[model samples]
Target: MSIEKHDASVPHTGVGSDLAEEPIGNPGLPAHTWRPTDVDDGAAKRAERQVAAMFVGAMVCSVLFVVVYFTAEIGDNQDVFLGLGASNLGLGLTLGGALLLIGVGVIQWARKLMADHELVEMRHPAKSSEEDVATTVAALSAGAEESGIGRRPLIRNTMIGALGMLGLPAVVALRDLGPTPGDALYSTIWSEGMRVARDVLGTPIKVSDMEIGDLINGQPMAIFEVDEEGEPLVEGVELYVAKSKASVVLVRMEPDEITPGEGRENWSVDGILCYSKICTHVGCPISLYEQQTHHLLCPCHQSTFDLADSARVVFGPAARALPQLPLAVDDEGYLIAQSDFTEPVGPSFWERG
Candidate 1:
């Protein structure tokens, strides 16, 4: 704790200079006191062992976190403890313990085993001289020597092991991101004969229900169908996934104003056309429409699509046209899908080809 104060009257130019200007006199550091571990060989050994134990505990906790991740069930049948899922509880406790033990181990090592000497540096020019750089390097070397990293193999090895083992939790957790979508992104629940219905109300839409200059948010009728027991056929995450891909916008315009793509002459019913609601740029739902221009706009990035002519990207960052769902009329006159989308819907991906 002994501090050497700089003389204010003299200017400091480089390292080893005891000269620097200060606004006031220095309040020197208190007298130095040696720690118990520094004075006693037995205490030093005990402290070293304690730090190594904590690092070893961190390593164990880290391993346990990975084990729990693989063994614990995540859904309905998952084990619960104190109102929390066993999977989550085990993960939190093990990961938290690993971090806590490592932190405590570092604190103990610094406080008890590492050098406890105090240092004081006076203000000097921003740029250091060659001599100052050399001195700094020497000081760093001395610090490494005093830290006992080279001399104490137990603490060093345990610390390295703990740090290395901590990466296991992160590596194993990446499994949760998959299994890859595969062909799921290429299709939806809009197979042939699936009726088109209003999005939230789930009411079937007929060609007569839509007038010229009208735009309606719609989804496949399969989601609204219920079982004989009066329970929803599609519910929960399944319903959400189906709605995300099957969602569409039905627009009605003057048939003469429409310009059908080659081989898509009968894709629309009269003047009414159906296209996926998802934007081609980034899978954002698009509803903003200009009935006068027969253009659909995605609010997310101002991507404009010409619904009058195959829903092609007319503006903004969208790279492709909106996927069209061919329309057909059922026996009851309700709008039904001629078939699933001819192409994949939503944002473009590497496997989209």
Candidate 2:
């Protein structure tokens, strides 16, 4: 064995080096050890069966996943355990089991049956030669034999079945994306007379409580409602989804500094305006505010919107402006929604016009 070194002072950018060291002699290959599957027919057969079992299990799980997906009523079903919907639980478990079985099958195949060898290839040209190609094919054939893939039809069939089953979950999940909205993107939970409230807390905001240059994050009142007994009205995944869609940002500036859009003159009071916190580009939450410019920036894609000018897209990848939530004062003088958002919030979707 020999060590090779390069001089520090040399400008070695390309293949040629000013102070290149000599090459070291190659070390001989280590002794090869045969796996139990390779030497023992019984062990090989057992391993094949094990791999086959995993694949069979994976396929069964995939079928169960489909069954769960179709049978589970995801919305308004009201069956809850540990704060999780029963439908969601069933779907997740079946899908997870399917994936896990496939993974374990592959791991077992590689560990107990696949070819295990040690080979040394000399460093040659960057491109492969005719001999290299021929050798590669031969190596693959050898590997297949050593792995007992061709010999063990059961394992091969099972692995193939397991791998094929993986596609079912992906295809089924795609349906959850739903039919493209022709105009759903232009709407939101915001509606006339809806009050703006602190998310989860459901507490209304007073215009006087907000100071100049203040930025307050909020959501729709419906998202944070309670039962008649003050119990949380919505729980689990429904609450999560509602919270995500209804998020908003409230900013207070000088009343004279605002430039409200046409037909939106009364949307603000005392220089306080509210807009969707979600970004228009990829639906990232926008909260980084520049108090002086009244500009909001999305942390995800760096999309910037100028709030003073109808929340217009100022810079970055966002194709549209932030959706504005019209604001009004209730008899109590607290900020309330004059209406829900005029447009949908978050990433551009086909439903959004």
Candidate 3:
């Protein structure tokens, strides 16, 4: 509760001489202040109960969150509030409330029950001496004792319950990541009749639209198809997944520069060729094309593929060539996929077998 004024002539053990040479002498700490809970048993008990009550409420909310998760109907016809799904609304509120309660309880515990005394820690070398390590361990033990956690049974148990219950939501939500993608990567939303359209703008491309040495970033029309009101039929996560896997690039080089793969001789139309935009190395979209050399470059890892030679690996980290999409013209003269990619697209994985 008190500290004697230091004799500045004999410098403190760990302090440098420069610190002791300041014009203003050490002011020392102000008088020790005691909180009402620290001096009165009844007030201390009341504060402890209030903190415990908060933790208990957190535990209750966590439990109710689990109950609501299991009971709430999440179908298209399920309950709605203010245009938000009822199940999502309930889960968010309960989880948020529970976390808020635990935070408030911890603040109350520290402010009212934990040690209020202050002590100075001297600056030292980066490497801790053996004596300093022992002192640190002792200080931690003293801090734990001052927090009154051992003496307050109600606070200790409720705080433990609240923290323990908090983990359930995380455990339950891991199920939402869904089952591992199996054979899903082997295919995409690109069907045989699906037409290739420009990315974002969704304008269909034709052989006449592209000139020699031209390359256009494109996506399948299925991802951008609109309903009666012209709103995209595929949207949100489904649209994202479709776009990622079905993305393509249409490139036109001199017909003499093309080197078609075995059985893929007809995969191109005139000088125009279609290839998966996703790099084989790690699935980064490949757009950096050099028309002079007919090479496609992946920026992520500098993986390069030769577009002229069936997108073959030219001079980079990619193990294989980019997958080719067979191209054909619809009656409307728009380029369409003759068939889905013959091989799986994107970076190779263990499940690729």
Best by TM-score: 1
Cα lDDT tens digits for candidate 3, 261-341? 899888888889999999999889889988899888899999888899999997888897889999988898889999999
Please list the Cα RMSD from the true structure of every candidate, rounded to 1 decimal place: 4.5, 10.7, 7.0
lDDT of 1 at 78: 97
* Candidate 2 or 1, higher TM-score: 1
lDDT of 3: 0.86
Against the true structure, candidate 3 reaches a TM-score of 0.63
Q: Which ranges of candidate 2 are over 4 A from the true structure?
A: 1-166, 169-187, 199-201
- TM-score of model 2 vs. true structure: 0.55
Model 2, poorest ten-residue lDDT window? 10-19
Q: Per-residue alpha-carbon lDDT of model 1 for 196-267, expressed as tens digits? A: 999999999999999999999999999999999999999998999999999999999999999999989999
| lDDT measured at residue 223 in model 1 versus the true structure, 0 to 100 | 98
Better of 2 and 3 by lDDT: 3
